[model samples]
Structures are given as C-alpha cells and as structure tokens.
Target: MKDLIKAINGHLAAEFQASHTYLAMSIWLRKKDLAGFSSYMLAKSNEERGHASRMIAYLVDSDETVELPT
Candidate 1:
C-alpha cells in the first residue's frame, strides 16, 4: 500500500505537470491568435487538473497521505 500510494502521488505530480504544460501551450496559441487551438489546450489542461484532483480525493478517501510534488 505504501508503494501504491507513492506511485499514485508520482502520477498526480505528472498530471499537474501535464496541466502546466497544456496551459503554457494554450497561452502560446492564444498569443498567436489561434483561439480554437488555445481553447482545446485549455480544456486539456483542465482535464489534467481534474485527474490530479481525483487522485488526491482517492488518497484522502483511502486514508493515505498525499505528498505534493516540489
């Protein structure tokens, strides 16, 4: 269970990183006047954030500690 928790935390961190990346891409797209692509990337960023939130909730429900990435 400890290892599993650790793995989930790692995945959560990855999700957050992915979210950040997508958000950055969205900003770049918007600056380039690509509204459609920017919106898509923004949606993807929200999805990744949602995934991370779900993971955090799962850990909380399981009575496990969630360690945020540095």
Candidate 2:
C-alpha cells in the first residue's frame, strides 16, 4: 500500500510538471498569435491537472496520507 501510494505520488508530480509545461507553451503560443495552438496547449494543460486531481482523490478515498512534494 505504501508502494502504491508512492507510485501515485510520483505520477501526480509528473502530471503537475506536464501541466506546467503545457501552460507555458499555451501562453507562448498565444503571444505568438497562434490561437489554435494556444487553445490546444491550454486544453492539454487542463487535462494534466485533471489527471493529478483524480490521483489525489483516489489517495484520499483509499484513506492514505498524502505527502505533498516540497
């Protein structure tokens, strides 16, 4: 169970990083006047955040203590 929790936490971290990168890309594209690309990146960023949220909810539902990354 600890291992499972650790794995989920790792995945959560990756999702957060991906979301951050996508958000940056979205902003950059928007500044470049590429609305379509920017929208696509924004959507991807939202999806990554959703994935992270789902993992957090799962951990909570399992009654596991969530050790947030510092």
Give each model's clash number.
Answer: 0, 0
- Residue-level lDDT of model 1, residues 1-70, one tens digit each, is 8899999999988999999999999999999999999999999999999999999999999999999987
Worst 10 residues of 2 by lDDT: 61-70
C-alpha lDDT values of all predictions: 0.96, 0.91
| Candidate 2 error regions (>4 Å) | none
Model 1 C-alpha RMSD to native: 0.6
lDDT string for model 2 (1-70, tens) is 7898999988888899999999999999999999999999999999999999999999999998776654
Top model by TM-score, which number?
1
User: Where in model 1 is the C-alpha error above 4 Å?
Assistant: none
Quote model 2's TM-score. 0.93
Worst lDDT window (10 residues) for model 1?
Answer: 61-70
What's model 1's TM-score? Answer: 0.96
TM-score of each: 0.96, 0.93
